[model samples]
Target: MAEVKASMAGNVWKLMVSEGDSVDASQDVVILESMKMEIPIAAEVSGTVKELKVKEEDFVNEGDVIAVVE
Candidate 1:
């Protein structure tokens, strides 16, 4: 399994993939809003999304796990 982590502290703006969705390495799975900018968080490995550790509008810190893939 792979854990997708936040690259920076931010509010989760949107979710691009849901549970059971397939994702590729480097695929953008979530958008985070911070510092008046939108940042996309990508999956680190190709796999099916197993869980979402965060929800839209939730705040996350840098390096926080946002999703799990397997």
Candidate 2:
């Protein structure tokens, strides 16, 4: 399993993938909004999305797990 984590403290702006979705390595799984900038959080491995730990508009800290891929 791989954990897609937040790159920085921010509000989750969008979810690019949902549970049971397929993802490739380096594919954007989430977009975070911080200081008016949009940052993409990517999956580190190619796999099916197993879970989403955050939702759009949710606040997250750097290093927080956003999704699980397996």
Best-fitting candidate, scored by lDDT:
1
Provide the overall lDDT of each model, using Cα atoms, as 2-decimal numbers: 0.98, 0.94
Model 1, 1-70: lDDT tens digits are 9999999999999999999999999999999999999999999999999999999999999999999999
The Cα error of candidate 1 at residue 63, in Å, is 0.8
Q: lDDT for model 2, on a 0 to 1 scale? A: 0.94
Clashing pairs in 1: none
- Scored against the true structure, residue 68 in model 1 reaches a CA lDDT of 98
